[model samples]
Target chain A: MAAQTGESASTVLVCGEVRTCLLPTTQALDRRGAAQLLRLRADMYVRVSERPIMHVLSPETLTGVDCRLPASDGSRTRAVGTVIGRAALTEGRLLQTTSYFGLPAVGPDTRRPWGQYLVRPGIVEPFGMLPRKATAAGVLQGARRGELDTGTIAEGLAAQLCRHELLDRRAPFASAPTRLRWVALRTGGDRPAALTNFTLAEDGLRTVKLRLPPDVPASAAAGLCEDLALHDWLLTHVQRMLDDHPFDRADDSRSLAALRPAVTHLLHLWMPRAHVDGALAHLWDTLEAAPGFTRQWQNLVQRIRDQLTLLDLAQCRRAASSKGCEE
Target chain B: MPERVFRESTAEPRTRAVPLAHLSLELGHLYMEDFQLGPKRLGEHFAEVRIWADAVRARAARRVKRPRISTCFLIDDYFTRFSTPDEVIPTVLEEAGRAGLTIDYLARESGCAVADGVALAESVAHRLVESPPPGSYGFRPPASRTGWLTNGSRSPASPPRTDRGRTDWEPPVETAARNHSIFMDVELWSDDKNGQRVWSCSFLAAVWQLARLGLLRHLGEPVLVPREQDVAALPPDWDRLPPLIKVSATKAAFSAYRTCTLVPHHFLPVENAVRLVLDQVDVDTAALAQVAKRSADEGMPVPPEVAQRATYVFYEEPGDPIEDGKH
Candidate 1:
């Protein structure tokens, strides 16, 4: 696998995007159905684990691309090779598709035949020397037309899985899916993997940039991002579930009714770093230190619980008053 | 790190290895029109294909020591079934024999769609990774809406309704163009009269290419596995024949590192579509790794790309004397 493609061809830059959403099934697929749904290839294993959640990760697949590198400095560098897309099911309630690839610092000047890239699965080799920093910024900033955008490839798989007949097409709630685009630049200099910048881009796009130890597997970086993305998605959903509701302004019970799904489907899914490889667990510490993921999550959790308590008290008062009037 | 805390046994991947050949030479393909044109047309088709098949064998020999080669033919029992195996198999074998060509494996086209209870076509459809044109920008292309696979960016379609947009014509652009665009979009499947999904000829051809290239698999098992049938006599019906019948005692594996199909000129577009579909597919990673390791160890390293492994020689279709009679 390209992940172990030696130090010389060791990833100079590792970047990926993950799309997370509630699986569009009226009822979330059970462990059995989740395993079946993620069987993208029969020859590959659909890894199912019950350690944390009934999680299922489909065998990783590759998509070949030969297009302009999405460079922030707008250098017209062309990259050629495959991008890896893996579908993951968390507790059979949420589906996340992550499309990712690593870049070597330099590659052949000309595009090799496609088989050359297939053997190297997820390695997207750039023509000539790769400007690692600029390329990383460019990808994180965004891709223009014809640029190699890993997020689009990720979205393609997510959309495809959502359309399967196995799904009832009726999501439990009408919530926008979140896109988390992450780029990890190899910190060749002595620096343990550190989360650099995590930006919440417009339209549910979250971009996380990391400086990782060169020796860490690119997949470990992706796993870290997926963990961050899943928790981030949970926060986003809960925030939306309580947005501008007149919980304090009115005696209406609709706000409480709307927030109930948040308690049921999402509250328990904030287990950040649950599936993240232990080696990369320290990266979550960086997140917790600054814009603390758990800090904001706990705040949101407290607010929701407080609101629910208020609603319950109001409902009891209203019932008691109504009964006395009727007597 | 004296002791490990916890480990889940299920989160592992394993790829079963399949036997491989240096080359898979497709003798030719027969469709309803070819079958309707009858045995004489079939004879002429094989005669034209025989020359190309010999050339491919020679090329394979030059590349590798004792290059294992397998020859196969596909019969279109999917799109429009004209005759049964009882009527068709004997003549096909006889014609190929007269042309001094041997088809080690005889496969039904429908088998590419569904063989031995596996939805192989649907599996491949899930694998279609589109060649992203410049400026893809994370926008998931609407492949689901059209069921079409294109080689490059399509002309901006006339907005679905008049109220939504104005009529402005845009030229379709090929992503890999040098000076001019030869953009092609292939429709892989459509609904029939009864609303049952029908896999298109081009899509099935793409799956056939994957099978020949030794890329198609379902659940760690080889797909379209050749079933040896002693040809005492042809089966009573088309359904009676095994999806893939091994007609020869040849030792070469049916799947190979590379494929060369002797298709008629009319199939050029279909094969082109196959290229588009194959280009985007991220084939199973573990399986891909095995192929790469096996080939490298064998000292006959194959191209890493699934699409590049496929080759085609399109000849003029044999004119139907029956059509001449109609004229």
Candidate 2:
């Protein structure tokens, strides 16, 4: 009920019948002369036609009325009256009536023109043209589909609309901080503006400089670099293998066993000798303590032992063959 | 109740006594009566008598270092047939504690038979409990051109004793050194057939024996060598070996010993022999110095480069038919 004043607008206390009946004339003037007169009458009728209405229409409603000739015969004349009625106005039927007035004929078969009607309260502009509730819902639905609204500041408007119960006031987007922090650490760069910041650049190669923690050790930095490199290499290798083989059909247990040597090699490349040994020991202990790695661990152990034995035999055979050659 | 008296006896523990009878029984199974000559006379029957004698002495010294009194007995046959000096000394020291004798000195006295030496060592072991001599006991053969005399008195008058008088009754140091050299020669000779079947069989048998006796734990893993250059700058002990000596040794001892017999003419060139002898002397001194320096320079950790280089791959040929099929 509180009204806010706009630029160049005068303050006016509009209430009751006065507020309801005072339709702005500028809206009607937007149409053609005859259409404008009919629209004005329609708007006036609509304002006055409440169920227990107590307002009279002003005589100025008839000022812009005009006639159009029928095409059937020049002699034949039809009288068309643009009437303002309370019943028609209360139900928003005035809009159709105004649209009918703009047509050439006043017959049941004639089609009504759209946007021929003015909206009321005529004096006060209808409390700021609200975005339809359905429109707001549509915006949210579009956002969920990853279709961003570029033209309007919908996010801000949405935030305001959802400020009450729907959204968390404390952290509306709590995951954002963690996501940004991860980006900062992993990329060694400044936190980006938003997820959209990444999509803005065509190549997605915008590098932002970042300040690291003051106390980070050089060795630790080197180690992180090495680990990342190895991890990347291992990921590529896995991707390649997956691409080459029927990975979906392979048994998970067999696949994991096959990956062990590569994984171990990667881990060795990533860490120092002491760390590698400790990691291996930890892995062994974990595998022993947990039932998950039992099958794979046993298979690997047997394979390694068998390999060693085979190597020994091969060496013996080679020695024998070389001796025979000498003889 | 009367207070229990905790008596502290001044006398040494009786467990210190050597069970010579037990050792004699064990040795009886391995050697003939003639082979039972004392450590001093052992050189006559065995090529490298002095090395075994020294090993016994060293073993005795090590045992005495421990608080417990222990005696070690060496079977003459096993002692004489060892492939290397490294093998003999360590094995004797490890097993010494099991025998009842508290090893004191390992002496080699000429003229005494093995049985006589065993008796004399036992008597000396008994005396050790009463703070007796700690040197080894062995017999020395008489210096005369003739063999050992049956009668105690000789026809000729005794020669004038030298001023820095060492009696003929004591074993000479020169004899011990000469005996050690001979032992080394025998070890080398045995090692010459390393790649032959006999050598392999013997090596495996020795390994099995050591394993059964729980001595194999001390032997560690075998060092693998593939190329002559790998052991080119071996430690002082191995330096005496020629550039190709290690390769030849490994081939002869491990492979050829099992497959075929190689004559000296078949493998050892004159140039290789000369180079091997010179390199052996230099390498042995360097190795000894390096070991001493290693212990002294405890703060600076030695890199494992030397040990890693020592490892060789005996057979690194193309994949076998079975491997190709698997692929």
For candidate 1, what is the DockQ? 0.25
Best by DockQ: 1
**Candidate 2 lDDT (Cα, whole model)?**
0.22
> Model 2, residue B46: what's the lDDT?
26
Per-residue lDDT of B214-306 in model 1, one digit per residue for the tens? 777776677788888776677878887889999999999998888888888987877877877787675765567667778889888777677
The complex in candidate 2 yields a DockQ of 0.00
Report per-candidate DockQ: 0.25, 0.00
Error of 1 at A6 (Å): 8.8
- Give per-model TM-scores: 0.76, 0.16
- Worst ten-residue run, lDDT, model 2 chain B? B19-28
- For candidate 1, the lDDT comes to 0.80
Clashes of each: 22, 62
lDDT of 2 by residue, A1-327 (tens): 000112012211111000011111222111132222332222111122122211111111210111221211222222122211111111111111110011111132221110011111011111222122222232222222111121112122222222323223332110110000001111122432111111111221111111122222212222222222222233334334334544347654455554444343322222211111111123223323443234533444454445445555766898899999999
